[model samples]
Target: MDWSKTKTIFILAFLILDIYLAMEFFELQDKSDYAIIQEATIEERLAAEGIEYPDDLPDDINNSFYITAKSKDFTIEEVAKLKDQTIELPNVNFEEDQSFRTLNMILDKPFPLPDVNTESKITQFLNDNIISGELYHYWYTDEEMNSIICIQSYNSRTIFQSKDDHIGMVVLHLNEDNEIISYEQSMLEQIKEVEEKEAAITALKAIEALYNKNYLSSNSQVVKIEYGYYTHSPLSNQQILAPTWHLTVEKEDEESEDFYVNALEGDVLQLTE
Candidate 1:
């Protein structure tokens, strides 16, 4: 046997192995950088302080959307009855709109609301005036110096994410004086359990879907991802709450835009004003 030749062969084999391992290491590092960037996003608003990040995230991030066809349905009467048991607002002018069978209430004059408000005050107001309030969870508050908007959602138990889940079918609007200037509500008669509780598209996949479709720019960062229900036709008597993924993307300019994707299916649900 040629000892020198065998030693040279072994050296060459080890060099190839080292190159392969180095390539794998760089790939893993790239993935780690992506995950770190994703986790660094500051969550300005949250339903809960400590939210568990999804464990099933992929090592490589790309633009792909998972889709499914599962959904639950309810009847018009059931929805109407949900509103029938609502509590009337005191000292407020209220009118029921024919479309979506929603109640639109307005104050005769603008009342004062505090710059800062408490959840209990908001919940008490809803508990006092909305029968469907018990079913909804307090989601978030959008406040200007003079006004605050408290958002609530129905069926918080099934919420998979915190982003927009609580903005279900009802929204409460208030002024700086803590006065309820107006409120808008839409109620679903029932929330029936379907066989499956799983979502086909992971939160990361939904963001990828947006990025692939050019709905999100590379410079934008995702601030929040939540599980919720979104209504496309608010005026329709037969309104359906599509299980949705609400992704709030913050741009380089510090402005944010909300992209709502269907949780079951991968379609982006757009809200019409």
Candidate 2:
């Protein structure tokens, strides 16, 4: 090989490689800048519409698993352990499996659940009075139905109530004295988390989903946003629970309502009360 020609060829090859790397770096930088711009625009747009979300919206993208569960199926022997309450099974002997799903109970005497400092007081009543109630957590009082609502929990997350007959909720009917009279409980047993957890859509993305769907009106205040499991099947015997973003929105002069956004799908769940 001619020494002068070989040196020139080597220099040309390195020059071409340097040019290619420079182009790749610029392209990546442009994408990063575009993403930041898009994020800022969304914040400004929400402000223009007078919609408010939490300033401390989680910056980290969370990971979660999709779960599957069965309706509470029990045998007469298992349910016989419940005492001081009249028990009724709605879906008994499901498919000749000799198992029941729903549990309706009327207390023999009113269980004392006071209205004051109920955070601790109600917890006490549940562990002492209700059977297997240790698994249930106080959700909220439904004044419209005159009931104290509780939801089943797992892994430190309680299934949020999106509908009246939620499969994981216990609807406790209150008598005239606001005491525990009776309740209907449905549980999701054998909950199995699907394989590896995947990154979930951000809370900001969830809120934007609602706004895109026209669920958020102007002057709407997003009071709270929480991550949990919520199901769309209110009456299904078996259900799939997905990670969800539960948002509490309040419009001016309007009562606050709960809205859910599927964290995985990034769509507003058109769930009903």
lDDT of 1: 0.53
Model 1 lDDT tens row, 1-273: 999999999999999999999999999999999888766542321112232234443233122222122222322344355432333344544354223344555645544444465666666666756545675545555555333334444445223222233223456666655677666564445444443455457677677667657766545667777765565544233334566677777776777777787767788854322
Model number with the top TM-score: 2
Total backbone clashes of model 1?
13
**Residue 95 Cα positional deviation in candidate 2, in Å, after optimal superposition:** 16
Error of 2 at 20 (Å): 22
Give the Cα lDDT of each candidate. Answer: 0.53, 0.79
- Candidate 2 residues lying further than 4 Å off, grouped into runs, are 1-35, 56-61, 88-98
